[model samples]
Target: MTAPKAWSYSALSTYVSVCTLKYFFRYVANLEPERSFSRMYFGLAIHAGLEAAYRAWKPDAPAPVGVAKKVFMDDLTIRLEDPMIEFKKGETPEGLLTEGMAVLDVWAKEARYEEIISTESEFTVPLVHPGTGEIFERGLKGWFDLVVKDPDTGEPVVVDFKTTARRFSGDKLEADLQIRVYSYAIRQLYGLDRANLRLDVLVRNKKPVFQRLEVSQDSEGDARLFELVRAAGRGVEAGVFWPNDGSIWCGGCPFTQACARWHDNPDALRSHSEK
Candidate 1:
């Protein structure tokens, strides 16, 4: 069992919570996915497009509507060249480009940031327990999608963009681990007690819908995040990884073949065992 040098929000949530087996496969064995998901490609393109638009934005000027669409199409075209990208049923590259353009159109019209503070801001900070002042060996690292000054409050707000099949529920918004981690990071970086967080969600529908959701943030969740990261690290050290069978995302996972072969192969586990 071994602990990583750092943990990202995706590591704590997607790898640890989603499936610990995935953590082992990715981190310990360092195995690449058999194929990439089209959704991942689509999201990359969308983010790139949004980043471009936001970069081109000027104070009190019109939104970069055309720039957003063009960049999305260009990025999508480049990503589509990868033959290993697996598209969902009835999802074509052409269809995705069309949908992405439409989504960006909605974003260009609806998304507003009075003052763009930063885009793609990367941060790495020590993971400190709030309750006991315990500092962990593994640090936390992640990138902020966008940061802007709020029109009403004139305070820096962290905004993350998501392209999803449906809008997130209130409970989901409140419970999001990313928010907790981001809140913790904001405090560490800015020395601010409370972090203002927002999610700009793009819903995939016949006609796309854009939603701006504000998440309640405070120092309360920081301790929980610290504990969660600690537990995940402990689990990794103990080599406690098991497939999350019957999960909805299992079918789309790139590790299906490797997961199926795990039980028959003690060598795989031994490869990462503490010497």
Candidate 2:
């Protein structure tokens, strides 16, 4: 198994707890996904719209609702041209465009930040072992959706944008691995002892909803994130891969066929490990 040059939250989260075989197929074997889901592309388009709005935003001005909707339309138009997207039942490009616009409408009204420090900020930090405090060669890399100063506290707030079918529960926000990783990154990059992480969620409903959930970084969560990253990295280096069958994600996994082949002849795994 070839070691990934760098690790991202998505990579570590999937490898450590989600599905090992899926990680191997995508990262180690470098296999193209058999199908791409429409929801993934829809989220990408919405993210682009949010980024555009934030980029054009001015302090103490009306939110760029029109700019956001226009960008979402243009972005989704281009994305829809890609024929690989497998739209879910009852989902069409036209319907999604309308739904995306409605989401932006709600998001614009609630857009209030004291200062927009950065948007889509790229970060790379050394992966240090939680137990030994040993820094690994490969770094952890990710992009911050938005970074701003809190109007009330005058503290740095790291924001992540999400398009969810339902509002995230407080427990879900607290337990999210992505949030923990971002919190850890903020400590490393901004030199802050504690991180304020917020999730700006656009809920998909008949009438869309926008909600912001805040989570403070704790030592335990940060330590858990570091340890998970360390374990995932070591597992990859050791060529450890397994399938998590009988799970919800198993049905729609793009690597299902490849995983089936792997089960029949495990020796095939050797070919992927060869340098």
Instruction: Summarize candidate 1's per-residue lDDT along 97-216 as a digit string, tens digits.
Output: 999988988887886546888999999999888889999989899999998887887778998988888877767766688888888898788888789998888888889999888875
RMSD of each: 1.5, 1.8
- Tens digits of per-residue lDDT for model 2, 218-265: 556756666677678788877888889887778668887888788788
Q: Largest TM-score belongs to which candidate?
A: 1
Give me the displacement of residue 252 in model 2, in angstroms. 4.1
| lDDT, model 1, position 96 | 96
